[model samples]
Target chain A: MSSPSRQPLLEVRNLRVEFFGRRGRLLALDDVSFHIDPGEVLGVVGESGAGKSLTGASIIGLLEPPGRISGGEILLEGKRIDNLPYEELRRIRGRQIGAIFQDPLTSLNPLYRVGEQIVETIRTHLPMSEQQARKRGIELLQEVGIPSAAERFDHYPHQFSGGMRQRVVIALALCAEPKLIIADEPTTALDVSIQAQIITLLKRLCRDHGTAVMLVTHDMGVIAETADRVAVMYAGRIAEIGPVQDVVKRARHPYTHGLMGAIPEMGADIDKLTQIEGAMPRLNSIPPGCAFNPRCPSAFDRCREEKPYLLPVERSQVACWLYDETGARREAAHG
Target chain B: MIAFILRRLAQAVLVMLTVAFIAFAMFNFVGDPINNMVGQDTSLQDREALRQSLGLNDPLVLRFGRFVANAAQGEFGVSFRLAEPVSRLILNALPATMELAIVAALLAVIFGVMLGVYTGLYPNRWLSRFFLTISLIGVSLPTFLIGILLILVFAVLLGLLPSFGRGEVVRIGWWSTGFLTWSGIKALILPSITLGLFQMTLIMRLVRSEMLEVMRTDYIKFARARGLTNRAINFGHALKNTLVPVITITGLQLGAIIAFAIITETVFQWPGMGLLFIQSVQFADIPVMAAYLILVAVIFVVINLIVDLLYFAVDPRLRIDGGRSGH
Candidate 1:
């Protein structure tokens, strides 16, 4: 754990992303909010359609066109960034925040030398000559554990193996020493064996640099292994958020509980790994009350009639009606 | 690289030999050059002498071999109608055609890629729509028709340019050029554009589609997330990626430009190899035709070789993959 004196590095409030097309409007993300303190690793876990990647993209100001931030306030170090002009946001991108994408192959420009790319990125955000940038780039490559960093600097992406290329991408993301790094499924595209190595590298890098990380992924195991705080998302809304240990050991929201149930224990004799009832709702047909209500096993009448907001529930924040006093009262009376 | 060029050169030489053989054989099938060159009133004995003197009496293979040997020495025999060295005619006419093609290709690439990149970037913008309309018009119109339209607009209506001939020629020992004077460039304008119109649109459409495709790739998204400026992402990343295909198309289209400059040259009365080819065909000038064929083939092979080398330079992936496969 880090010091409690530092403010949260990133704050997202009521982040709503919508896709507008000629057909109509589709709400992709609704009222999603979370914050990452300096040097903290916050893992966002969800199914494929849970808008985990979209939230990551929106925070990095790289949301694909037509799908945009319709309503939200994203602040980096207390300055609202969601509404800044493009140039200003661009300046903040490498200078204050960096991003690590999923696939290493596509994350790099195949036409450029890896060293030159890192150098260019360094030069773009920092006041440095080519020689200085090149020197720093080599240092970063070495820091990321690339062998013969100086010699490998002249090599292209195609010259490196997949794991080595991922290492270079990590080096590229860390070149500018940003306060925050948004990693969207950074290890999912890596080999299974190499995934842990990258995770450990990221944790070490963040810890050493005091850089906060927002790790987006659907792997609960990864969240458990690395994250300080875990947010479980279902159908574009966060079902629960809390310290990883507390949430994993004693889950609160039914959706989070179902997700945890699906992780097979080591050599445990069980009927089968538990399965969540239904697929995440499509953007157009997201249920009115709680997006997870249709698939929630403990859903009561109040869960269907009214949407619930995140509320403090003993060591975690839960959005389930079971945590609400009025909802609990109604359920007891009905029983 | 030198070894690669040498290998390519060897291949080009083989192709040129085959092309020369085809041209020589093709001549025998055409109407008798003597019948066209000499009047019908000429005595039969004299006509026979003319044919013999032109080496028509030799065996077909021998004749073709002689033609190839002379071509190797840069001596393309003599033209039937022009009664001059075929090499001289090509040398004299090449400058004008080359000047036209080079300027047109340069201008076409600049405008086409510029328009294509923006149009692909913003397909719905009014400027893109307008450029797309221009490209459509360019694609539909024939070169001769485009030439006529330019003449009407810039020549007759505006009275600002010339419509015929290669302007005033400035002879410079073994070479003469029309690009030496202001009037020469003025005359070249209408024809160069007319010849370049189709290529421009073809290149525009190619770059536009390539740009659109590259924009969708994961690298572009990754580049955006890296916080690259819009200009860097568009031109540096997207445009550089699009250039390979555009360069390829431009290379092939440049060959086509040289091939079809005949029509444009005829319409505008520009003195170039294309017009020379047209005149030689009407006169049944076999040597000139054979020489022009070989020249065009060499041009195409050389251009393609350049394009391949450029591909290796522009894309390191190509170099890496190609190097591995080469082993």
Candidate 2:
């Protein structure tokens, strides 16, 4: 138990995802690797199509067909989950790893009562009688801050407001007491005023349950407030990963730096927030050397020629040639 | 809830009155019923007397009012050709048509849903493709043609069943059923299939599309993530969601089966109201024709009402009151 505790709760190594389309095969995710420690929040921040949600989906083994994992290993508590049979994976899904999705308005089934959905989830992964499951389900609803949970349990999802529905969804995800929860843009569909409340509630519940969370979102403010560690993704690859504060304050990768700059500082009177010059590359048209090189502001000859992998830069692991010590010396020689 | 039902009831009543008026107007002009009623040898004076006694000379409005009043009282006057009360004639023919329609509808819905789920779930499998191809054929082929082919196969080539008529019916009170007798049950098989084939395919396609759409919803994905088994996810969640639309189509199709069982009944010579309706049309029996139309319209209106009510049961989103009572 101690040895396992020392190991990360979830490890994704060299994950590659591909989509087979009529035109040809397109690589969606390439050499993506990351891990989450027990009871830690790993915020995955990226623009849309950066594979932030895809990564979470791949972890949960729910990638829609025509898109599949071409290579990689996903392990939870040192057991390989990527290759498990569907039934085996299903058993592990809610028992060991659960998932919450975007759009709480559409997450819980509208046909069933709120409590029934949660109770069904609990019973599926755990050995409990219907009555016991219902009891546990009500308790979960209360834990997520639903008022009059026992009475509200029998109500349909539509009866609840957007924020309340999200609370229900969170409760459902946490009901099985899974070690990890893959929350893909969980708060992206909520009201702005309700966003912080949901985030705080999620943080509190996961902490209370000791459940590690892979919070995939594009909101930097959300990451700044909730995530313990942050991985900034660019073109389906992790551009930089470090302690949330370090990455936010002193971003090493140019892409990460541009993202941080894009977020407007509250009190600073600036003409405009910094904008990244070009869009992320299309999957089929990504440049050979580095995906971000064409759009990169500080692109050099080396950056345009050879791709960079994550290298230790102070506290963060940044994938940029500028942080490469040997490459810097070689650049000096060329200069 | 009561107000919603009451509103639908009022709408149903209005629709029925319109249908009744239309049927009365249309059949009233399908040539003179008096000419068909009287023989060539009958005297002109007797014919005039017959017309006067039948009140054909009454004003159109008064006649229409009388027709509606009699129809409302379940008295559709008398059939000119059979010289029998039209309502009684319909009552005698009704059991056979109803039994055939009910059997056919059950067959369509049960197998349609099963095949639909199978095709929706494993759309790429050869069996599913075969089912889809079969459904395409079912949808395209005319009902009479399908009935003839079924007869050729089962009755001619195999000699396993009778070719025509509702054989060996056992009367239980007034509702005679073919189910109790082996010959009656066997006789029913071909016509029921012929009647149900088109509706089965229609329902299959509808369910398949709905199932595919529902399977892609966030709730279904969430159900999968919640680690529900494929069976539970597919049937318990996806199938239930598909049922709202499925119910609407199924209800309408069931009504269609009853109304359009004419071709099937004609093919089999089945002693049903559709066959009676066809004979009445050929003989210019206006009262029977008008009654048949009104009856079919009533069936459609009642089915629509039932379907509207079923929506509240299947989908909670439409239930404005919410589940405050934990029902």
Candidate 3:
């Protein structure tokens, strides 16, 4: 067994996901690679069709029909779990790697009481007495900041407000004390005020438990606030990734720059926010060569002719030829 | 909930009264029950005297009022043909018909739900397709035809069971070994299958469609994300969500089953209320037919009320106003 201190909780490499559409097979995620060290929070940000959610679903082994991982290796605690049998995959899910979904109302079973759901998830992986499970369930509920956890355990999902239900969902996810948690837009369904509360709760609880999280969202503000490291995906591939501050301050990829520019700055005097020049290309009509080449403002002949690999750019990785220092230097000196 | 029940009960009473009035009007339209019961050879004086004695000579309004009063007191006037109380005859036949209908419904619901769950979970698979084909055949085939086919297969060809009629009514208590015996069950099989086949098929298709819809819900997907096994996701999450529609269809079909019982009873020769109903119609036993019609109408109303109540029980959201649509 690997020591918890040295080993990363989850590692994903060269992951490719595809969906069979009427036109042809559409690639949702292409050559996606990332790792979540123990207790790390890695935020994945992208446009609607950029496959951030697909990556999270693939990692949790919950990809639905018509969408499947075509090529990938998902390692959990140094064990390859990409091709594990569904039964084994289920055992690992919730117990080894918990998940919190975007919709709070749906993430928890409506028919069951919040407390009962938590207890059930706890007992699913642990051999414990019902009383013990019940106690632990209450503790988790209280830990998640739900008031009167004992009494509220009997309440159904509909009885709770949207924020409270999300707290319950988070509690249910944490019941098994899994090493990793994949939260897919966990706060997107809540109001703006409640969104901050939930994010704070998630950060606090995960930090206390030393649980790594792969937070998938389109909200850059959420990434800036919560993510330790950030990965920016564009058209099924990671366009850039690095430390949150590095990526936010010195974003190398044009897509990342466009995303940052689109956000409204607090002190800026600009009359209107800067929007990207064009919409993200449709899945079926993705441009040839580099998927982002058409969208990139600084595209050159080489960018149009060959797809650029994710090369190191300063403190971050950028998949654009403009950031290729050696090639830039040679062109500059010769010209 | 109490208000709903009271409202439903009031509606049920109105429906029963309407059914009674219709039955009476139909009887009157068919001409004198006395003339139909007696022969043409009877003297005119005797016919007039018989009509007066039977209260047929009274005005239409007076006769209707009298009929309603008598019905309330359980005196469905003496059967014109049998010369017995219509109430007594209907009471005697009711147990047999109720027995058949109840057992058939039970079997249908059990088998239908099982088949529906299986097919919904594995749609387009061979087993599901096979069940789908079988259910289609069941839906298309009439109850009497299915009954005759079952008798031909189980009775005539194999001699595995009796062709018709309830076996000896052993003098044991109602809940005795005789009722529990394989012999009693063997006698009931043909009638039950005949009565149940159509309902079974109807329910299976309804349940399958409902379940297929429920399986696509976000909650089911969330359950899978929670690491629930496929069986748990299908049965625990999807099946429960599908029950409201199934319950509604089952309740509606119960009314149809009552109507079907008449034909099934005639085919099988089981001395149920349905058979009694046909015999009364042929012999112009007006009282018995009216009583039977009223009883069936009451059963329909009661079943619908129960289904409405069940909606609240199955889905908590329905307890609040406008929650049924949410589910």
Ranking by DockQ: 2, 1, 3
The regions of model 3 sitting more than 4 angstroms off are A1-5, A21-23, A326-335, B27-30, B33-66, B171-183, B320-327
lDDT of 2 at A318: 89
lDDT of 2 by residue, A2-21 (tens): 47548999999999999999
Task: Tell me which residue pairs clash in candidate 2.
Answer: none
The global C-alpha lDDT for each of the candidates, from Candidate 1 onward, is 0.86, 0.91, 0.84
Clashes of 1: 0
- In candidate 2, stretches whose alpha carbon ends up further than 4 angstroms from where it belongs are A1-5, A328-335, B39-52, B323-327
TM-score of chain B of 3: 0.89
**In model 1, what lDDT does residue B175 have?**
68
Identify the superior model by DockQ, candidate 2 or candidate 3. Answer: 2
The local lDDT score (0 to 100) that residue B204 gets in candidate 3 is: 92
Interface RMSD of 3: 5.4
TM-score of each: 0.94, 0.96, 0.92
Docking class of 1: medium
Arranged by TM-score with the best first, the candidates are 2, 1, 3
Q: Residues B1-327, candidate 1, lDDT per residue (tens digit)? A: 667779988988888888888887766777776786788799999999989998899898888888788888879877888789888889989988888888788778888888888899998899999989989999998889988988998889999888878887787886676678887777778888888888888899999999989999987887776677888889888999998888899988888888778999899888899999999888778889988998998889889889888987888876544222100
lDDT, residue B236, candidate 1: 86
RMSD of each: 2.8, 2.4, 3.5
